[model samples]
Every structure is written in C-alpha cells, then in structure tokens.
Target: MAETSRQIPERIPVNLIVNGNRRTLDLAPWTTLLDALRDHLDLTGTKKGCDHGQCGACTVLVDGRRVNSCLTLAVMKDGAEVTTIEGLGRDGALHPLQQAFIDHDAFQCGYCTPGQICSAAGLLAEGHAKSTDDIRELMSGNLCRCGGYPNIVAAIQQAMAQS
Candidate 1:
C-alpha cells in the first residue's frame, strides 16, 4: 500500500427541512440529494438504483414536488422541504398510501416501496391522476422490478379514494 492520500474538498453548508425537521449539513457541493439523505442524514428510505435518474427508486418530495433525489445536488435543495418515506406518517400511524400498499399487497421485495409510496403521495398531491391509466402514466417513472404494477396501481387508487 503506497499510503495513498487523496485531497478531499471542503464541505459547504446546506440547510433543509427534512421529515419536518430542520437539518444543517456540511457536505461537498457534488453530493447528491440522495447521498445527503442516506449517507449524511441516515435517511436510507430513499434508494439509489440507477444513480443516473433513470429509476425513480431515489424519488423524494422536495417542496411538495416529486424529484429524483439522485440527480439533484444537496446544495440545490438548500432551504427546501424534503420528505422521505419516513416522514409520510404521523402519530405512529402509517400514511394512507403505506396502508394501501399493505392492504393491496403492492410490494414483494419491497425495495421500491418507499419510492413508490412517495411518488404516489406526490401524484395525489399533484391532483392530475383522474383515472387508473393516468396514475399509471404519471407513475411510470418509478419502476417496480417485481412486476407489482397492478397492486401498486391499486394501492395508489385506494389511497386516492381515501383522500
């Protein structure tokens, strides 16, 4: 081992309100929102599937909008409200989408469940999905490798109905 020493850049300050908690973090400007959430904040509910923004597994709500966290830099979301899967519920109760996923058996491996639910919540919030087909189209970004599309749609529909 040649005692390799690599220079690390200085971390910049970024502020965000995550899961209803204000967080101040010092991180490299190149750090992605997904990395900031999972690596720095220990909020691992956001997954990194493609790291290229092709997969919605890293989806999160930034200022009430659905975003691919992996493609977004931490500094880009500074002073923004970020919501991960862990923030969807309150009072020890599951969010409607979470419960719907359980009731509809929307997940198998469950790896993409968090992103799916978050995306669904954003979909509902956007209020653009008027039909199942619309939901399918809007949620096409979040891919479920287990082929649980039907159940996932049903879960979203259930959550939408409840809303």
Candidate 2:
C-alpha cells in the first residue's frame, strides 16, 4: 500500500485601507471580510446577523460601495478601501447619517444600525434616491428586526436633504 500526503492551505496576504488606516493581514484564504474585520482586526461594529448574506447587518463599504462583508472574501478585496461603521465618524463628531439616525431614532436594538448607516451613506453617494420610496427600495437590504423602517427612511431622507 502507498501512503498519500495531504495538502496544507496557504495563508494569503490582504491589504485593506480601513477607517482611514491601512492594514496588511496574512489570513487564510477562506477568511471572510466580516471575520477579518470583526475577529482579526477587532472591528466589531460590523455585525454578523446572518452569515449567508441574507441580512445586511454585516454590510460595509468596499471601495466606496456597499457590500455584505460576510459575502466578500478578505483576499479578494486586496488594495481596496474598506469602511466600516467605526470609520464613519471622527473625534466625537458623527457622520451626517449617524447624526440623522440619532435625530430620527432610526434604531432600537442597535444591532443593525452600523449596516444601515453604511448603506445609507452609499445610497446618498450614489445620488439615485430622490424620494422616500426610492430610499426604501435602496435600503431594503439592511433589515432592522426592530421594525424601524419609518424612522430609518426618515433619517436617510433627512441626511439626504442635508447632503
């Protein structure tokens, strides 16, 4: 009988500009961006509601676009600018969306707030939503189990108007 050798998975290097900070990490090829952000880098602001990408609680900005962090592989986003909820504000000043969320009470449980804010920022940047219906359609991906859609839409509308 002949013995066969097993292959060992190799670690891949991933470079990401997160929250205005550059990070280089050597991680397993299978590591998801959400895991890298939450587990490795300790950026837990991105939630893990449903790892399958059905829920947008793990949403983040990759290269200025909203993406489900859990659905994106860390190695695939090399040289990309990644922005999580923690990156949205600076020096105790909240981002416009963040302030809007607060002003409108857009969150209740707060588990989905990060993703909601990130998605709203992306929507505003896209400049496609002009009405509450459009905002709802664009932000439908981020689910708040607390059922804060009305306030969420209001917050986004307020932020959009201000922007």
Candidate 3:
C-alpha cells in the first residue's frame, strides 16, 4: 500500500463566500487572496499582474468593495464575500458592464479587461464618479498596455448611463 502524504501543519483555515458559494480552504499563512482564488479555488478570472497592488489586474470585489487581490492576504479576507470576474454575471447573462465593454471595444489585448470591468463595477457601486473625468481618475489603477483607455472609459460610461 502507498503511504499517505504528510499534511502541512501550519496551514490556516479560512472560510469565504466566493461567487455566492461557500468555500473552505487550508492555506499557508502568506498566501495572497489572488493565489488562493486562482490556484486553490480555480477562479482564474482574477489575474496576477505585477504581483503587487500597483497593477490592478488582480482586482476583485470583497464584500462589494473593489480591492487589489495581489496585495491582500487570503487569511485577512476570511469570511468575506469575494466576487471575481467569473461571478460578475447572473442568471446566464453577462454583467451590464461586461456587455458595455464589448459594445465599446474596451479591450485591446484583453488582459486587463477583467480587472477593468471589476473595477468599473465597484466604481459604480461606490458612486464616486460623477463624470467621465471622474471615471478616468478613479480607474487609474487598472492599466492596459495596449492603450485602450479611451474605449475602457467609454464602456464604463455606457454602463453608467444604462444603470
């Protein structure tokens, strides 16, 4: 018979409400929320860019507020509600922001689209943007190397107008 592998004793227990589903995980103390989502939970929609908070490609919503997932520790967000790009939609339909992004051609390389949409969703929920400039200013963290800022802003504006 094969011997069982040793269990990691230092792993911490964490509970999360991810995409409206309860998830329990035993993670290392230093595991970032982004790694937990992508590696452990298999939710790769939350990307890993720069591995730092400076690049908002790893943005996700924690308890309805947008956060940089790369810098946040998994244990810190235990019991929190996390929403990734995959969970942004409902009832077999794309999210309004997602549809708006498509309509406005908000992406060039498409790498930053997920984070852009997630940030846009949180921006709308935050209700801090009153104009186009406000949206541009607020969404500065998420960067697209392909220079798609104009279209990204347009998508956000469209979603805002529809809402």
Q: Candidate 2: misplaced stretches above 4 Å?
A: 1-8
- Give one digit per residue, the lDDT tens place, for model 2 in 1-163: 8999987568988999999899999999999999999999999999999899988999999989999999999999999999999999988899999999999999999999999999999999999998989999999899999999999999999998898
Evaluate model 2: give its lDDT.
Answer: 0.94
lDDT: the better of candidates 1 and 2: 1
lDDT of 1 by residue, 67-108 (tens): 999999999989999999999999899999999999999999
lDDT of 3 by residue, 45-144 (tens): 7888899688799999999999999999999999999999999999999999999999988888788888999999999999999999999999999989
Those runs of model 1 whose alpha carbons end farther than 4 Å from true positions after fitting are 1-9
| Reference-based TM-score of each model | 0.94, 0.94, 0.94
Error of 2 at 74 (Å): 0.4
> Model-by-model lDDT, in order?
0.95, 0.94, 0.93
Top model number, lDDT: 1
Report, for all candidates in order, the number of backbone clashes.
Answer: 0, 0, 0
